[model samples]
Target: MELTVGPNQFFWPAEKWSAFYRDLAEAPVDRVVLGELVCSKRLPFYQDCIPEALAALTEAGKEAVLTSLALVTLNRERKLTADLAAMGVTVEVNDLTALAHLPKGLGFHVGPLVNVYNEGTLAWLASLGAKRICLPPEMPLASVETLARAGAGLGVAIEVWGHGRLPLAISGRCYHARLHKRTKDNCQFACEDDPDGLEVRTLDGQPFMAMNGVQTLSDSYACADYQIEALAAVGVAALRLSPQSQGFFRLCQSYRERLNGTSPAGTIASEVLRRLPGTRLSDGFLTGPSGVSWSAAPAIP
Candidate 1:
């Protein structure tokens, strides 16, 4: 399976954002989806850098895609969604509303945020010119296999969430602003402080989830290390890796090595813990009774 880098879910400064994509041009990933996916408010900070980043990735032979906002609410947001097509790249529709804005017969891609739970939904999307789809992280292996088989027959590539923190939900309310005792409108870019998102804890102090503006993410990164073979065997087309602030270039290389048969299962998870101490890894959503369960033995503490 090939590797695909999903859009950055956290907010970062314009220079840092440009640098990340510049570095990605050399990474082993085959496709890169970039744009503001979480909050529209965060777009202005780094919007200008998109063209240069897209050019760099395109020049490096990577399939570059622009993503529609996950939650499009206002009239201006609708206008923004409508304008994505003008960028001259494939638009990955995270919100179905974005689909309505696209010109008829224009080919596009579908992101994980769109609910594509069954064959009918998959077929309909394909009919609507969806050339590829990255399945939601919470989907089980059985469902993925089914979708992969369906996608193959329909001529649509299927991708799975191979790595990064699981995106649990997106809300209209900004959690970061709420934490700072500020309303969403009046709040100064609070989510910008945590480049990788602020980790939320339980009352007992256990890492529970992460807060990035209106998005809620799992505290543990979802590593598909153990299930790579199983997914590939089922005809999966690609693995989507979400962007992280630390060691991401190395992370892409590690997954590339694994896919190239030079690295073994569990190596990715181990390397992740080594690079970011105390980082939990999970594959339970792909195989499990719980979303946070890890498959590898002697789980990293």
Candidate 2:
């Protein structure tokens, strides 16, 4: 299976963002998704860097795709989405509203942010020139298997959230701003401090969730260690690894080694959290009854 780096989900500084893509172009990854996926307001700060990054990835022989914002409510966001289709690269639709702006027969990509819970949505998206889909993190293995089977017949490639801080929810208000007692407009980009995200503790002081602007993610990084074989058996095209603040190039190399049969998933799993610190790994969303269950190695079937 290929390692496709998902979009950066955090609000990073412009130089850091630029540097990440530069390093990514040299990583052992097959695809690199570049663009802002969380907040549309943060886009302008690093928008100019996209063209250069896109060129770098393409020049390095990687398949690059532009990701639409997960939530697009304003006119500027709508315009941005409209302009994305004209960039000459494949568009990865995180929001369904993007489909309205995409041209017919162009074969756009579906990101994990879209609510593709069942086969019907998969088939419908496939019919609309969707070439590939990264299934939502909440889907169980049973549903993934079924969708992968249906996708094969539709000539569409299926991918899953192989690794990342599971994006649990999105809201209109910026939680980071609220935490700092500031409005979204005047809040000075406070979310950039935590490259991954600020951990949200429970009432009992458990690391329950993470806050990044308007997006809420799981405190644990979602790792699909034991399910790779099952995913491959069901004809999965690739495994997505989300970009973290540090050790991401090394992270990509590890996943590449795992796919090539030279590295153990356990070792790679251990290496990832070593650099990112204070986060557990979970495959429960793929195997357990709920998204919060913690399992190191989950039963695929």
Candidate 3:
């Protein structure tokens, strides 16, 4: 299985955003999906850097893809989705609305945000020129196995969410703006403060979820360290790694080594805790009692 770096889900300065992709050019990932996946308001600040970033990744021999917004509501956003096809790179659709804007017979990819639950849905997307699909992070292993088998038959590559905080949901309202008592339009870019997202805590003070503009993410990073072998054995083509603010280059190397059988299982989770103290790891969506449950022993605090 190859490592596919998903787009950065959090807001950052334009320079930091450009630098991340510049550094990513040297990382061991096979392909990358880059562009705004959350609020469309964040696009203007860094959209100009996309060409440079895409050029760097492609020149370095990585397959570069552009992603449509996860929740496209405005007319401009629809125009943005329609314009993605003209970029000369594969478009990864996160929302079904994007499909309407893409040209007929144009090959595209599907991101994890799209609800691809069963064989029927997989087959339908395959018929729509979907060359590859990253299944939703919340899907269980049995379903993934079934879809992977179906994808193989349909000549489509199937990918699984291998790492990063699970994207739970996306909403129309901006959580970051509401937190600052501002409306979604006049929020003044509050989400940019937290590069990885602002972690939301429960009433009892436990880390519960993270807020990235309108996107809701799991507090614990989802690690497929233990399920890598199982996913690959079932014909998964790639493992999607969501970008984080810290140690991401190293994280890509770790996943690459793990896929190559050079690094053992549990090493990735351990390394995450070492670098980001208090961070938790979960694989329960794949092997589950609950989504937040961890498959390995708890990391030492």
Candidate 4:
């Protein structure tokens, strides 16, 4: 299976964002999805750098796609979506509204943020000219297997969330702004402070989730260390690695090696721990009882 790099979920400095894509151009990834997905306010800061990044990735022999916003509420956001196709690159639809804006018969991709729960939804998107789809992180292995089979029969490539923190939900309210006692409109770009997002703790002080602008993510990073073999065997097309603040380039290499069978399963998790010490790794949503559970053992037969 090929390795696809998902769009960056965190709000990094414009320079940092440019540098990340510059380095990623040579990384061992097959596809790179760029553009703003969480908040539209973050776009202008790095908008000028997108063309350069796309050119670099394309020149480096990678399929680069522009992603649509996860939630298109404002008029400006809708206008942005409408103009995405004119960029002359594939557009990954995170919101259904983006479909209406896309020119008919223009091939597009479906992002994980959209609810693609069953074969019916999958078929519908396929009929609408969706070329590929990155399944949501919360899907169970059974559901993934079924969808992969369906996608194959329909000639649509099926991808899974392979690495990085799981994006659980997105909302209109900016949680980061609320934490800083500001309204969403006048939030002052509070999310830029936490590049990987701010961890949310429960009443008992346990890290439960992460807050990033208007997006809520899982505190534990979702590592598909053990599911790689099973997913490949099931004819899954690709594995998506979401961008993080640190050690991401190396992490991409590790996943690439593991996918090519030059490295073993769970080895990526080891590198992740070395780079991000104390980070909780979980693949529970793939098979375990809950989203936060991690199985040290191999895939269950």
Models 1 onward score TM values of: 0.98, 0.95, 0.98, 0.97
Minimum summed lDDT over a 10-residue window in model 1 is located at 292-301
lDDT of 3 by residue, 100-145 (tens): 8888999999999999999899889999999999999988999899
Model 1, stretches more than 4 Å misplaced? 297-301
lDDT tens readout by residue for model 4, 1-301: 9999999998999999999999999999999999999999999999999999999999999999999999999999999999999999999999999999999999999999999999999999999999999998899999999999999999899999998889989998999999999999999999999999999999999889998999999999899988899889888899999999889999999998998999988799888888778899999898898888887745569
In candidate 3, where is summed lDDT lowest over 10 consecutive residues?
292-301
lDDT of 1 by residue, 213-263 (tens): 999999999999999999999989999999999999999999999999999
* Candidate 3 lDDT: 0.93
Q: After superposition, how far is residue 154 of candidate 4 from its true place, in Å?
A: 0.9
Whole-model Cα lDDT per candidate?
Answer: 0.94, 0.88, 0.93, 0.94
Q: Which lDDT value does model 4 have at 214?
A: 96
lDDT of 1 at 243: 98
Ranking by lDDT: 1, 4, 3, 2
Q: After superposition, which runs of candidate 3 have C-alpha atoms over 4 Å from their true positions? A: 298-301
